[model samples]
Target: MRESFYRYLMTKRDPNGIDEISHFANAAFFDQAFPKHSDDYHEISHYLELNATYLPSMSVFDEAWQGYLEEVI
Candidate 1:
């Protein structure tokens, strides 16, 4: 799953082409990647932490999370 997600991340792009990442876009990706886990925040957090290597970096993932939250809340 982590490998699949790593491949998936490579395909992600921000439509606006500003930050190279879009929280709204990634939120959609999350749902697609982990449909069952989407409702479970703890699972999501754990998954990200465990698969942190699949991501560019913890900081990048964090920026995405924060960006998502900012737009959401």
Candidate 2:
């Protein structure tokens, strides 16, 4: 999922972003980023806060990912 999101972001958000994405993206961020709707949002934002060079918030990541899903689905 991380790889998917990374690729999505690379093409959509930051075209000039790095090609290498962290391997732990799925384990570290995916689940949190896409949880069920709740009044209190749990940042689900990328957990790789330290490694995120271009992608900023979960909202941004989610948008790119949703677009990617729409294309592939």
TM-score, per-candidate, Cα-based = 0.43, 0.36
lDDT at residue 73 of model 1 (Cα atoms): 38
Q: Give me the runs in candidate 1 sitting further than 4 Å from their true place.
A: 1-42
lDDT value for model 2: 0.40
Q: Which model scores highest in lDDT?
A: 1
How much lDDT does candidate 1 score?
A: 0.47
Off by over 4 Å in 2: 1-3, 13-50
Candidate 1 TM-score to native = 0.43
Cα displacement (Å) at residue 6, model 1: 14
Scanning candidate 1 in windows of ten residues, the lowest lDDT window is 1-10
For 1-73, candidate 1 gives per-residue lDDT tens digits of 2223223343455665545345434544554454332433356557766754445555665565554454443
Q: Point to the candidate with the largest TM-score.
A: 1
What pairs collide in candidate 2?
Answer: 32-44
Tens digits of per-residue lDDT for model 2, 5-71: 4444334423344422332233334444433232121332423354444444545555544565677
Minimum summed lDDT over a 10-residue window in model 2 is located at 35-44
